[model samples]
Target: MRKTSVLIRSIFTETLELINISDVVSKSIRCDGSELIVCGRRYDLREIKHFVIVAAGKAATPMHDAVVAELERSPHVWMNVTALLISPTAPRHERANVTFFPGAHPTPNEVSREAAESTLSYLSKVDGHTFVMFLMSGGASSMLEAPIDPNISISETAEFYGALVASGLSITEMNVLRKHFSLVKGGRLAVAASRAAAQCTLIVSDVPSHSSDSVGSGPSLPDSSTVQDSISLFEGLQDRVLLPESVISFFNGPLLTETPKQTDKAFARSFHRVILSSTELAEAATRLAKASGFHVEVDSTCDEWECRDAVKYLLDRTEALARIHPRVCLISVGEVLVQVHGRSGKGGRNQHFVLSCAMELRQRHSHITVLSAGSDGIDGNSPAAGAIADWTTFERARLMGIDAQSCLDTFDSFLVFKELGDAIMTGPTGNNLRDIRILMSDHEEHAIYHEF
Candidate 1:
């Protein structure tokens, strides 16, 4: 059992490295003296005088480093280069031309506003001789925000986010509302950059669909959502949600403007590319599982589903797969939604998912081990990445005087896993592709099967 656990952890670690930001950026973006290439689009640097780099998200620093490295290697291409990075933390590598602004995540704050203002100020200076390089990833939406209505207090915005988190809204739905209220989201940033000669956006996608318009609310791409979509989603959740009166009124009233459209002039000179996604992560895990001598099954449903239903769905699939193969490894990639009601405890969607699976495994006396974790290395409000559970997880929790069912009811899976020492902690991984789940069953092989 100990050996199996060690092998599983090793595989997960390797899977994360396969989609690291630095590697992904280095492979996708490059520059020569005459032309700068990104994801196959070429820009003539000889015609551009000034280069501006704006980056945001959890992976902002590393992504910035990668971009700067590429530009530095081709100094003849961009002689005058300036950079502005907005991230949850400071930069890992500091350079004279680069300025880093630290901001809040999962919720926007005053720092987020300052970051937006600084970016806008820099972008406002762009002219036909300038080239804009925008780097965006998962946390960009929260880290880079400037409310359209100055009257809307930051507290009101925070309250709106709090309600959305508690309401278990999908990332797509939440981003629609965010776009309607922000000055920087929904392709407005692209409009601002339109003054430049050309614009290129390199994205590390955390959203399930890998839609350029959905990732980071499409700051540098055209928005597919509209005012009507935002209003319809809000109306459906109004009764069960705790949204501010000001927010409701703002959406219900006619003071809203549509985001930039695909036909808008803003995108005429812009090129958007998704460098990394959840599908790549899942494929990497599948390859590693096969090399480790396990029959691999990959499921690519990487959307936010209800916690309980997701756990049941994975378990049923795993059980059926185990009956046919003696050594089976099921790889499921997606984010689960956990609705927090009343007084909630500390935990993220990944922790809630594994805990639910632990309870079901204990009830059925099944010998299965499951691991769920965020690719970014932070789960919800807790410091732990996520949690790991097996058939013995519930029994071990009981021995530690922790009630698994009670914890799940209050959304406190972090505490339950903490007490049992089953929490997986990787700190901030500087990457966000979504969540990865691994389920394994070896019931048929009572003896450990050797690859020899």
Candidate 2:
């Protein structure tokens, strides 16, 4: 059991290396002479005299630094180069011509609104000679904001977001509401900079790769989700806790506005590339698993699935594979939805997922190991990134007098996992590509199998 724990942790940590911010940026973007190349789209910087960079979300700081490294190494001269980074943390260090603005996450605050205000103002001033590079990742949805209705105060805006979180809706459904509520989301960010020479968006995608525009609420991409869509989703909210009346009223009132669409002029010069995503994360996990002598399979179809359903499906797949091979590893990348009930406990979707697996794996007598963790290195309200569990985890918790079901019932997987020393702690890896779940097993002595 101890060796299984060690092996899964090793695989998870190594898997995160390939998707780091520096590597993602360097591989997807570069500058040669007077040309800036990103995702194979080249911009001749000789004619474009100004360059504007806006890096936001969890990876904002490192993404900014990596892009600056490229810019600094270049000998090409520009009339002016300005950069702004909006992140959940305070500035780590100051760089010339770069301004760092601190913002909130999982919720919005005054700083978030101010950051959005500054960004809209700055981009609105850029001329046709300026080429904008928007480096976006996961947390930008809350790290940058401006409400469409001035009557909706910052508190109201934050409360609205909190309501969406507790609503148990998928991220896409939640962002539908966010896009209609914010001034900068749903392609409005690109519209504000419509006058710029050209703009390109490079995403370290936490959302599904097929819906990369959903990252950070599609700040640069055209939004297909509409205000009517938000109203419909909002109308169906089962847990409307902390939902503001003003937000609700505004959506139903005259102030409601539709998001920018494919026909919008703002997207005419816009371009995008998904630099990193679950696909990359799954590939890395597969390579590591194969090198470790396991028959590996990848299934991301469970993405955006409810946690329990996702666990059952993945575990079932692993069991079938383990029957055919001496050693098996099933790799899954993407987030599972966790719907909170009543007041929540300290845990994220990943921890909740591992705890769920422990319940199913209890008394199974199999050498199976499961790991689910965020690449960003944080999970929900807890400090631990995620956790690991195996066949022994349940009895181990029971021996320690920790009730797995009760903890899970209260959304408190973090407490049980921490007490059992199963929590994976990696502080702020400064990257976001969503979550990864690795399920693997071995046929060994004292490892007989049974099904739930």
Full-model lDDT for every candidate: 0.84, 0.85
Tens-place lDDT digits, model 1, residues 1-452: 44556667778889987777788899888886588888887788778889999999988888988888888897765469999988877776777888888857888888888888888889989999899999999888888887887777788888887788778888878888888888899999999888899898888888866466778777888999988998888887796688888888788776678999989998999888888888888998899989988898987454588888888888888889988998889998878887788888899999989999999987876667889999899999898888888777777778888888899888899999888877888988888888999998875443443211
Model 2, residue 138: displacement in angstroms?
0.5
Model 2 lDDT per residue over 31-83, tens place: 88778888888888777888888888998888777787778777454226788
Q: Which ranges in model 1 have alpha carbons more than 4 Å from their true place?
A: 76-78, 444-452
lDDT of 2: 0.85
Query: What is candidate 1's CA lDDT for residue 7?
Result: 66
Q: Number of backbone collisions per candidate, in order?
A: 0, 0
- The TM-score between candidate 1 and the true structure equals 0.95
Residue 32, model 1: lDDT of 60
